[model samples]
Target: MKKIFFLYLLTLFSLNSYTQNLIWFIENDKFGYAHKTTGRTVITPQFTFAGYFSEGTAVAAVGNHLLSSKYGFINEKGKWLIIPQFNAAGNFSEAKARVQQNGKWGYVNKKGIFIIQPQFALCYDFKEGLAQASVKNNLWGLIDSTGKFIVQPEFYSITDVFAGITCIQKNITDKWEILDIKKKTSIKTNFTRMHAFADSLAPARDTSNKWGFVNTHGNWVIQPIFTNASSFSEGLAAVEKEYGSWGFINKNGEWVIPAQFDRPGYFFKGLALLEKGSDIVYVDKEGSLVFSFKR
Candidate 1:
């Protein structure tokens, strides 16, 4: 039994290693290099525009066309593997990417061959096993990577996919609903406004304008009491009282850190950006200030 448990843990680690690392354009403008482990830039800052690295290559823009920037692939050495062609492009996922031509979106394999023809009005990067696409009617829906419609275009808007479920807001309705892709049924909740779920729960606003959280099971683990609330991150959430200051709350809705910061962004990398008047600081879970940055 101990050997079996150890093997299971190893499998989990291997699976985690397969997940993609987030590469962002992090300089003053759209041009930047891939952020690397030594806290250094992978590709030098020379390209006019860049996208995140995926599957060992990145999409970059060349030439000076402000309105018609063309996209091509570059390896770690900044060598162009694929020449600039698509007017717009997204990063590779599942060995393929979505490219735009003549204002329509379609899919292309790593070799730049179109596996799916350009048709949709809008297309998104693949996550989990599906991607979101939009049609002329303005309703968005989910499609498999092969361009097959898994969920028909029925929602007015579509957010990120998490835990095999997608958060969608229907047209002419202010309420947001979670659609189970496999079950094809909406999770029942009483939230008047809802952002996407994070850390297994979503921040929901009640009719009274109070904010709280609800799990994917449509159960309220935290009651609607705070005047404002941000999404949960790293086991803690930020909340604000009516006409009051902002603070951090644990999963149980207890104030782990009291209301003190005049304004706070959601927690990231074990810290949150706090603002007071014109000053900005990074605070830990205990509300103690850690780092400060000038605006």
Candidate 2:
């Protein structure tokens, strides 16, 4: 039994490693994928639109125009795993993808079968076995994988579930509050605004409009100082120190990459995209330019 468990763990690691090595790239007006390390094109640009791989599949679209494109799933080799049919699609999460049929959104299995029928006016990708769905434009709630409402539609807005916690706004004028979804209880917080949690921390704004990081328990992990801040990703987050200047900071709130770029993005797979002057570039954790691309 121990040997069987070891093999299962190894298999999962291998699959994760393979998916992390690929990044979507754009060529001409088409989208393709390339190796993250070597920047070698693994799949030629063909799709009108493409998204990062998740759960061993990536979302791609094909059609003459963006407005009329039909989205589908593709494998590592760029072959269509699920034929382009849906008017829109999202990345696979928890073995299911949100797809739009007719005009309503629903969740479908990897086999392109609707496990959850298209009824939602809008929906988000599943996170932590739960997803935010809405029957109306402004009303949102949480639903389990079985399409049953664990939390009925009431919040004006709901952030993505992370670490079993989510941030929700009760009304348009209501401040965001942390909720422990599993426990169905609200966590008392001093924050005036909060974004979705990532890497165990959420980018939050205090009553003074200063940004910082907060833990799942609603305690400030990093004190509010920055003018603007983004959620942590792979241990680093992009923060705006002053107007128009952004840099990367560690969890300790230290500027790992000094405030210089006009704009900065969160680190993903050891790299982050930044903009300086009129140039858009991908840089390593050390702030070394990996490559520049046309935006």
Candidate 3:
């Protein structure tokens, strides 16, 4: 019995390490997972929809159509860890995954049990131990993992908290302001639009409709020069110089990758998704093609 238990523990540890290197890939209109380093298909493309692995599990669907399919959680071996039941599901974060049931959003544990019962009209995954949830009327607020409101449900919308900072809009007519989560105070700024804070910076739009990067103090760290921008990730951000051309830029606002792709996504685990014409490809930090999945 002792030898059997030791083998089980060793298997669990190996699976956990393997999951950290998995990335989702699409083939023939179906989704699967692959080893990020070797581009080896770990799980064949069988699910109608699949999400990136988080905390050793991924959300996947197996129905003929996405709208009619049920979502569930799968392990690194492509086995069902949580049976398909949720109307929709999100990747696990902080040991909980957001799931939808009967049109209401809530959180569930790795065992598929509700940690936070379904209540919010809409919700997002937890980041830094806090999540954005909304009650009736679409009023948003920040809630802890236990479903308790850290910031009361009054804002029209609240961005995800990062590095102790977030952006909130009180109403449709109100301008966006930076909220210091630790200090519980708003920093004055005139942000027409803003995204969640990431990598110590947030993408904010100026009055002239140009996007730039801002520090937590609501001050511009990189002036508004790009026609569009995304939040920083892995020390770089995606920006657009022209309407149809996107590229990557360092925090210093210098181009790291030339503006050539039709669309670009933020870097994750040293790879970022880009579209050149009709092909979808992943590129490394230096703009070298890592993998391509033709749609």
Q: Give the top-scoring candidate (lDDT).
A: 3
Task: Put down candidate 1 lDDT per residue, 1-295, tens digits, no spaces.
Answer: 4334323322221111111322333243345554322335555566656654677777777767535778877776678877889887776777777888899999888788898899999887777878889977888999987899888888887765778777777875657777788888887556677766778877888878788898887678899898888777778887897758888888888999888767656654455555665455556667776644332
Against the correct fold, how does model 2 do in TM-score? 0.88
* Model 3 global lDDT (CA atoms, 0 to 1): 0.83
The sequence of per-residue lDDT tens digits that candidate 3 reaches over residues 83-167 is 9999988788889988999999999999999999999998878888999999889899999989999999999978988977889
Q: What is candidate 2's lDDT per residue for 36-98, written digit by digit as tens?
A: 778899999999777768889988999997669999999999998999999988888889999
Q: Backbone clash tally for model 1?
A: 0
What's the distance in Å from true for residue 6, model 2? 42
Give the TM-score (vs. native) of candidate 1: 0.68
Looking at model 3, residue 112 earns an lDDT score of: 98
Looking at model 3, residue 157 earns an lDDT score of 78
